[model samples]
Target: MISSTLIFQSEMFSDWIIYNDETHGEYLVTVDHSEDTCYCTCPDFQYRKQTEKFGGAKLDDNEHHCKHIRKVIQDGCS
Candidate 1:
């Protein structure tokens, strides 16, 4: 099972942290407006989502939602 907890968040709720119970992994996630972009420190985001095909752009705009990023968005940045 995977889950997330908000460790820190800016007033705008753009940046925060998420942790995994099973993997004991901590991920940093950032949500940026003007694009609703989500960045995650997890390997999935670094190696898979953030790709080299589009000159280092996210691999697939519609499919780049990493677990950490999705959790942040679902949590309403709370």
Candidate 2:
């Protein structure tokens, strides 16, 4: 299994898909263009989203994103 996160995107497409590896297993994180946001199956993402919503804490902001999402962007599409 791939230990590191894998990012896939195309120049023509605004959406991105990441193959993220977790302790339990691997999950896919999709950056949906229509929604203009990223969604992940990992619990961390869900919890953070809800916490940020209620806590009014900006955890995933412009310069910050979930580890999975950050990996995708940092890894690059090329």
Candidate 3:
């Protein structure tokens, strides 16, 4: 079950900033629910076309959900 707290703490859910630490550097990450995916400013997303193919796995953890999204649900529920 998705927790309401997770929704409250998510930058994606709250219109805050989201970023990813990459090999090259840090890049902004954006979540697109309509498409059920995330876009990062990193080279992996920009040049390789890996983002579209592996976006879901990259975001999901053991719970089959992204950490950011999970945080939002937890925070929102709390």
**Residue 1 alpha-carbon offset, candidate 1, angstroms:** 4.5
Q: Order the numbered candidates by lDDT, best leading.
A: 1, 2, 3
Residue 15, candidate 2: alpha-carbon lDDT: 38
Candidate 3 lDDT tens digits, 3-68: 221122353323223333342233344555444454444454455433346453233332443443
Global fold similarity of model 2 (TM-score): 0.49
The estimated TM-scores of all candidates read 0.67, 0.49, 0.35
Name the better of 1 and 2 by lDDT: 1
Score residue 20 of candidate 1 by CA lDDT.
81
Worst 10 residues of 1 by lDDT: 51-60
Q: Which runs in model 2 stand beyond 4 Å of their true positions? A: 1-24, 50-64
Best by lDDT: 1
> How would the candidate models be sorted by TM-score, starting from the highest?
1, 2, 3
Q: Say which candidate scores most in TM-score.
A: 1
Question: Residue 6 of model 1: what lDDT?
Answer: 61
Taking the tens digit of each residue's C-alpha lDDT, what string does model 2 give over 1-78? 223344555443233444434444565655544334555556667665423332211323534366655665565522
